[model samples]
Each structure stands twice: as structure tokens, then as C-alpha cells.
Target: SLRQDHEVVGVRAGLEEETLGGGGSSQFYDLNVYLNELLCIARLLDQPFQQHFRLLSSSLSSPALVLPGPPKSLARCRAKAQVDYRGMRYPSSAHLLDVVRTTWVVQDEESLLEALELLLASQIPLSSPPSSPLRSSSSPTPSSPSGHTVVRVKNGFRRRGGYRDVKINVVFSSPSGFRVIG
Candidate 1:
């Protein structure tokens, strides 16, 4: 009976290995696929056998590691602009500063949100935003007579590991200020 049990365990391991090792990029990509396969294998064994195999499988699998990419250049540009326009200047300089300030603030806030999302999703710490471009629709026009402009910003986070991380769809109805709908 002991010899029979060992043979069964060996056979089960072989089958699991074959299923897991089939041609693919990585097992982490489709967790559901492996999980379904695991469930089928579990059903073939008794309670005690199932527990043993579960431990073996758990030991064999590792959590996926996602490496963060280099810090974004936009943040640096924003900082430099802020420093360069720190002092009061001619009327035209002030106007230019106002434009730059508004644009920079919006971009900075967006970057903050993206960073937060990445930290939550990947369990990786990123000191700066990813290099991916921010998506913004054409300047909003008055959809209603209320003098409000409806703008849409669609942004997504893509990891350096070739996995598309998150898609953020935000809509803002303004003139009274920005309100995010997502």
C-alpha cells in the first residue's frame, strides 16, 4: 500500500508538471488556467492526498515580481519650470507663468494618482510616474448653456514587464471646477 501511494504521488506530480510546462510565456499570465488545472488534479485525490499535493504545488510556485521603470522626465520639467518662474516678472512673464502653472498642476495631480494606482496594483514602490503619455481629449466645448466645458482624460498604466496595468477613464465637467466621473 505504501509503494502504491508513492507511485500515485509520482504520477500526479508528472501530470501536473506536464500541464504547467506546456508552451507559453509564463504561468503567471493566466492564473485561472493553472487554478482550474489544479482543481481537476485535486478532485482525483482523496482528502489526505489532496493536502499533500497542495503543499507540493504551493512550494513550486512563486509570486510574480514586477520591476519598476525609470522615473519620468515630466516631473523634472515641472520642477524646473516652477523654480524658473519663482519671482515676479513682466506682465507677459506673469501670463506665461499662469499658463504653465495651470498645466503643470493638472499634470502633477494626474501623475500622483497614477503613482498611487501603480503602488496599489503591483505592490512595488515607485518614486516617480511611469514614462507613458497622458491621454487628453480636445479642449472641452460648452455642451450645455451653463458655460461648463466637459473634458475627458483617458489614461492607462503599463508595466515595463509588458503587462497593461490599469485603464483610468475620467470625465470632468468644469467652469465650476473639475469634477471627476469614473
Candidate 2:
């Protein structure tokens, strides 16, 4: 089985922030939401994901090269922000993966901070409102903006017990559609 050959290398956590952007919190949330999605994939192969993946080690190397020796090709990936017709924040998980690799890397305190930012970004959407709308609306837009879709911001805070906590706030959108002004 795929899991048998490759140990269920722990899920990749916040890397986007480490390499690119960051959230305004020291504590980061786990991508447990992605776990359900991954587990669902594992179950397809009749495998149980029990093993955990922690950071073995990391340093400022030239990064992994596609081919060995000089003239090596770097595996580069870009993180793009996606916005739905309605404006909503979709955390850039794909960007995080491009940064620190995975969450297991947060062994030390400093790395933890970086991890938190990346993880937070992953949880949220990567998008901003378009400068100009493709089409104009004759009717006045709703106050909420996103309409039925809701936008939530969960803040991650550091605690005394060397752990972090998250608080979530849900905001309903207005009737017309959500707007990403920023």
C-alpha cells in the first residue's frame, strides 16, 4: 500500500507564512481540518494514518535539486491567491506547504512563531477584492457583502502552558455579495 511504503509522513502544516506572509499571532492552529480530507484519501487505500511526522532537521541549504550535481534544477512553487465570485478569505494552505515544508518543523520556539503564521495563512483564503468589478450592480449591495456565505476569523493566541489557543468569529455577508476591499 502507499502508506506501507511511505510512512504517513505527518500532514504538512504552515509553510506559506514562513516563506511568504504571516498572521498577527504567535500561536498557530493545526491543519486538523485538512486531516479529515487526507484521512478520507487514506481510507480509499485501506490504510490507517497513525504515524506522526516531526521535523528531523533543517538548514539554509540550496534546497532539493531535481537532479543531482551542478546545473541542478530547483523545485520552485508559487502561491496564488484565489477569490470566489463573492469575496471571502481562503487561507493559503498551498502557500504554507511551499514555505516550511510541514508543521513537524516547529521544534524550537522561533520556528514555532514562523509555523504559526504559515499555518494561519493556510487556514484562511489568499485573496483580495478586485479593484474593479467585472460587472456593475444596479441594486444596492447588501451590508454583509458575502450574502449566504460567511467569513470567519479565528485568532490564535499564545498561552502560559507553552500552548496556543484559537478563538473564532463568524460574520454573515450582506445581501448583494461580499467585497474584498482590501
Candidate 3:
């Protein structure tokens, strides 16, 4: 039905134009006019198919956007006690510490680092008695007279990679709770 309708219109237009005696300069001009009309019809016929093909190809190449489910290991770990911090629940103290450390590194703010240091210095019990059987009970954890905790630092040098490849997480907390000035 569509094919017949198009053909009828084209034939009627051609007949009307021929009867109107529109002046044409040469054979080349007539040929060019014919080609232009043919091209217009071809484009009209092709548009729907082109759109359909584009949609089909895009769907085939990529998955539909959908919310992801919780990670399997995280789901299992969630069965244990969770710590609430910064409006989020973490599976454990270690997880919370890791997240805090990562946030500190990502933000790269001097104030945040200082705040973290203060929080760690105040919260963590640095002078607790040694739990090792070899060490005496009277010996307290190492600290400076100014109340700064003494930390042992060991540097591991790698030949191939730069600092960008390395990730560091530092956790500091006192027995009471974690605090930041600003």
C-alpha cells in the first residue's frame, strides 16, 4: 500500500511538470534534476531502517544501566558487628580505619592530616603495658616526654615504581573516641 501511494505521487508530479513545459537548458540539467529527486526518495525510504539499526547496535554492544547488588564478601562480613561513622556503617574497626585513611589521602588536605594526627594522639592508648610474655609488665608502650607516641619506621625501597603506585593508610585513635578540631 505504501509503495503504491509513493509511486502514484511521483507519477502525478512528473505528469504535471511535463504538462507545465518547464524550460530545461540541456540533457545534463535534466539528468541532475532526476538524480536529486531519486536521492531524496532513497533518503526518505532509508531513515527508519537507519534508526532501527543504530538502536540495535547500541543495545548489543553495552549492557543496560541498573543498580548493582551488594558485594558477596561485604554481605557476608556485614553479619558481624558494624561500626557507625560519618553516617555510614562499617563492618569492623579496621574497615572504618581504612576508609578514613583513604579519605585523608584522597583529600590531601594539611588540616585533615593535622586533625588526624591529633585524633590519633589523643585516642590511641600508646602507653599500655606490653602483652608479650617475653616483655615485663612494668614496661609501658614507647612515648616521648611531650606525650607524642614513638613510632618505628622502616623504609622499603622499590626500584621500578613511582610514589603514585603506593598507597598508605594511617590509623590513630584514643581509647575514648576519635576527634578533629576542624
Candidate 4:
């Protein structure tokens, strides 16, 4: 089993709510939403990459995230889409993974703030009209005018007690079709 062997098939993203009762807030994203957003970003990064993935399994009830190196401990995580990122099977998939790894990191409060700032800087609300200069129908962000699907910022100023977590969705989409993994 993945948990027993501690096999890291994919990236481990920790999403925690700092506030004692902020997990349920609408401002923050639930696990489902977070994964879906990620899936969409993957699609946006490279259309070919999106078609290469398939829904393997979702350990939502017990999503295991094994930390590498000393003091290896599990973190709160979710994996909805699994891709064939091994070697030449899907060349661009590795790049997508690298982009995800580069953007998603949560070691401490400072790191979390930095990531949040990145998201805030990189993303604009999807609700923005097409005419909005900051966003167009096709472009994801100005920094990524070429091809870079990054975190999308949503409204809501969380309370001080809220958890320090990034919301993600669990979704999978292949050439066959799109399915909500969870």
C-alpha cells in the first residue's frame, strides 16, 4: 500500500486551516475545490498533459502524504488525478509536475505567506469579465501569457485563527472525459 511503503508517486501539498473553525468557511477552498483548480491548471498548462492523465484512486478518507528525509511525517494531502509521468510516456507531464512543485510549498508561516502572495500576484478572480484587462478569455495570467496555469485567487479575508492551508480540488480529465475524482 502507498501508506505502508511511503511511496511518493506524486507531490505532497499540505492544506491546513489555521483558524480552529475556518475549514468550513466558504472563503477558503475545501479539498474538492482545490484539486479541481489544480486539474484545471494542469489542463491550462498543456492540453496534451491533461489528456495523458487518468483517475487512479482517491485516498480522500485517508490521503497519505509522506515527507521525505529525516523526521518523515505525514501531512494533510489529496491526490485525485494520477498521470503517466514516467519517462517519455508523457514528456510534458514532468514539466507540469515541476511547475507544481515549484509553486506549492508550505514549510512554515513565512513560506505560507510567500505562497499566498504568489497566488495573489499571479491570479485574478475567474469572475472577472472577459473585457477586464487583467484577464482575457484565453490568458491565464499576465506573467504566464504563454502557458502557465497557476493558483487562482478567490475572495474572502480569513480570520486570524484560520488555518494556514491552500485549498485544492481533486479532479481528473483525460481524452475520454472529465470526472470528479472524489
Candidate 5:
């Protein structure tokens, strides 16, 4: 069995290695779960993950597109936008949180907001503290937050169509320098 299998498990694991933190999808690492904890820490809190984004969109409703567990990197060649320091074609933030994760956090749910504020308090600007109260679902913010910038977004869930929930966008700047949220 050993000689027959050319690709050993150990070698494969090395390619998809990730810190104790969530895989670098930046959903949780990117909020991939980073929001649940590390709100009290002082210094920049960040986790390293390696994953290739496959058509990063506002909502990944298509059950067809399954998330690559263990975090995998794409080996395709693509142009990196350098004008305003745009890293890769794929965005690293504001994918919106899946309801399943929050167990459908709805009205009278301020815990999520409070938790987010605490997580991003250090990097928050005096004017805005990343506390985006749940707004009228009728009107969702058109665009979401950018990776480099952590401006609070007015939209979190879709009010119409397949989307129906809305919440504040969370931003966490890691020690190595990267923003991830839910």
C-alpha cells in the first residue's frame, strides 16, 4: 500500500497547512469563525489560510459550489491589480454570513453586533465603530466592504430574491495584516 500510493497523505497535508485559526478563506479567518472569539485581544488578531476563490460572489446559494474544506490554493495564473493595491482578482471580505452559522439571528439579536464591535474596537474609527444596526430589509446596501478598507456596510443579507437577511459587516485586522469577517 505504501509504494503503490504515490501521493502520500503527509505531503498533501503540508500543502493545505493552516494555523490553529480557520482556513484562510477569510470568511471566518476571513469571519470564518474569527468573530466568535478573539474580541478581547488587544494586538492585531489574524489567522493564516490558503484558498483559491472560485468566483467570489455576494451570495453562494448554489448548493453546487461546495466550499473546499481544509482550504486549498488555486494554481491558475491571473493578473494582480496593482493600481490601488488590489491584491488578487478575488475579494477577501464581505461575502455575507450564512444564516446557518448564526442560527438565523433576527430581531432582538444585538449580541452579534456587540460581539463585532468588541472585535473591531481597536481598529475602529472614532466616527464609526463597525456597529451597523439591522436595517430595513427592504433596502440592502448595494456593495459590501473591501479587503483593504473596513468601512461598515449597510447590507448584510438579501431582502428580495433568494436573500432575505441583513446585518452589519465585521472586520478584523490580523497581526500579519489582512481583514476578514462575516
Candidate 6:
């Protein structure tokens, strides 16, 4: 595949046999450049020769977009940013636990339900000394079906219309009482 370009040029000039059989595209060019940059960074850092030697021994592969960031920045924004930094250190030390993931903000009821399901799935059960005590619904409620357990999170929690950053909550459990009441 890399020889396609060579083949075309060779046919036009009547020197098909002498061409190096190289078919380099724009992507191939970009990949070569990216690899060169990566190699240069690794070399300048004074990493062991064997480490650089390994990458040199293998064929170079192209990536769509390769943006490297620092590990400390990544750790701080771990909750918000989804980054694959391979392994690099930053120049600063900062605690960044509270970075909110923009994707978590839901605009509609359908997305709200989806987000609630995802959140509920991630929650661990309350321990013996419960942080918040659970209470049963006074009478029949729409959100909780007859057979299922329910704890009213807060009154007047509407799904539709304009949204705010109110913390809406719900929990569901099995009949055998592997329950998650929040």
C-alpha cells in the first residue's frame, strides 16, 4: 500500500522498475512527523538508551491526535477529563479532585433518567452506621412500583421543563433485600 504513489510516478516517467515502491499519503507523512516528535521528546529527557532503542526497533504507527499532558494535571482533573497520557510528569503540584465532568450535565428528562441510573449503579451501600436514615413512602406512590422498595428523595422533583443543578436522587433494590435505600 505504501508503494502506490511510486507506482503511479514510475508509470508516467517510464522508470517503474527503479522507484522505491513507496506509497506515502498525507497521513503517512503526518505519522512520520509525530513519531519524530515523540522520539525527540524521549531523547531530550535523557531516558535510558534501551527505552528509546525499543521504539526504534519496532515499526512506527500513526495516531489520529497525540497530545501529551502532565500526570499531576491529569490526576487533579481525573473526575472531569478523560485523558490517556501514557506517562509524563508535569512541572507543578496541584490537588484537583473537584473538577466536574461536563458530560454529567443533563439537559432533558430522558438524559436525567439515564444519568440517575448510571449514578445509582455506581453507589456503594450504606454501612451499619448510615450517613442518612431512610424512610418509607406514607402511601401509594407513582415512582415506586407496588413490589419494589422506595425512599422519597425529596418532594416536588419534576423530570420535565427547565433544569438546575439540584441533586435528584433515587435507589432501588431486590426483593431479597440486597437493598440500596438513599
The C-alpha RMSD of each candidate to the native structure, in angstroms, is 28.9, 20.8, 36.7, 19.2, 19.7, 28.2
Candidate 6 — worst ten consecutive residues by lDDT sum?
A: 2-11
> By the TM-score metric, which is better: model 1 or model 5?
5
lDDT against the true structure, per candidate, is 0.25, 0.25, 0.26, 0.28, 0.25, 0.26
Give the poorly placed runs of model 6, Cα more than 4 Å off: 1-104, 130-152, 155-166, 169-182
Q: lDDT per residue, candidate 1, 70-133, as tens digits?
A: 2223334234334653332211111111111101111344554654343233321212211111
TM-score leaderboard ranking: 5, 4, 6, 3, 2, 1
lDDT of 2 by residue, 1-182 (tens): 11111112222323333443457321122123322332222332121101111111223122211111111012121112122211222222212211111123233556555544443433323233322111335533333223111123334554456656342221212223222100
* Model 6: lDDT of residue 155: 29
By TM-score, who's the top model here?
5
lDDT per residue (tens digit) for residues 125-174 in model 6: 43222111112334212221212112233323556556444343223222
Q: Which ten residues in a row have the lowest lDDT in candidate 5?
A: 3-12
State in Å the error of residue 138, model 5.
52
Candidate with top lDDT is: 4
> TM-scores of the models, in the given order?
0.14, 0.19, 0.19, 0.23, 0.24, 0.20
Per-residue lDDT of candidate 3, residues 1-182 (tens digit): 21101221120112223443535322223224332333333233233323322332333223222222221233222322132322221112112211111111222344434533443444333333222211234532322111222122223334456653223222222121221100
lDDT value for candidate 3?
A: 0.26
Off by over 4 Å in 1: 1-25, 28-30, 47-182
- Tell me how far the alpha carbon of residue 39 in candidate 2 is from the true structure, in angstroms, after superposition: 6.3
Error of 1 at 171 (Å): 55
